[model samples]
Target: MRIGELARRCNVSTRALRYYEEQQLLTPGRHPNGYRDYPESAVETVRRIRTLLDAGFNADTIRIVLPCLNGDDVDMCPQVAAAIRDTLHGIDEQLRDLETKRGRITALLAGRQL
Candidate 1:
């Protein structure tokens, strides 16, 4: 298969596939003509990548855990668990910061003291 076929099967754009390759997430071989030659298993690899990205896992974390993924199941070793916990903690911190900003804005709108 080629890049186009892999992108179609994965329902993602060729640019996205290229970006994935650039991110070192997907590795496809090349033909003598300089065209990318993707393996048949690339389809499943793309699927897993998309699933992890949609779940808010960063490319760095996904790279670490990609090999641990088998279909929808994850090995969830200590590293994976720690990665997940770190992501969750980051999200929580962002939410708390947003809440504080919202409270400050609301107080300003209500003309109340902080």
Candidate 2:
């Protein structure tokens, strides 16, 4: 399919698809007329990319992790595991920071000093 069809099927803008291509996240073949020709699987790929982005994975992380996520294999690569672990650690730190901020707000509400 062409880029427009792929974007419509995926519910993403053509600009987003082009950005994905620029980031090396999605690759589309070029037609003789200079149009982009995406494979049928590109639809599913864009869906997965959206899911990952919604989960807070940046393009760099998505680029790193998508291949590991692609196959029917149940196991992931060590690098994938490491990246996940790192992301989890970042989440944990953010949670802790939020908790600390909540505590400070609670103290302020109680008329106590920080």
Assess the local accuracy of residue 112 in candidate 1 as a C-alpha lDDT between 0 and 100.
Answer: 93
Candidate 1's displacement at residue 12, Å, is 1.5
Give each prediction's root-mean-square deviation over alpha carbons. 1.7, 2.0
Most accurate candidate by TM-score: 1
Pairs of residues at least 3 apart in sequence or in different chains that clash in candidate 1: none
Clash pairs, candidate 2, are none
Model 1: per-residue Cα lDDT over 1-114, one tens digit each: 899989899999999999999999999999999999999999999998998899888999988889898776889999988998988898899999999999999999999988
Question: Lowest-scoring 10 consecutive residues by lDDT in candidate 1?
Answer: 64-73
The residue-level lDDT of candidate 1 at 95 comes to: 94
* Best candidate (score: lDDT): 1
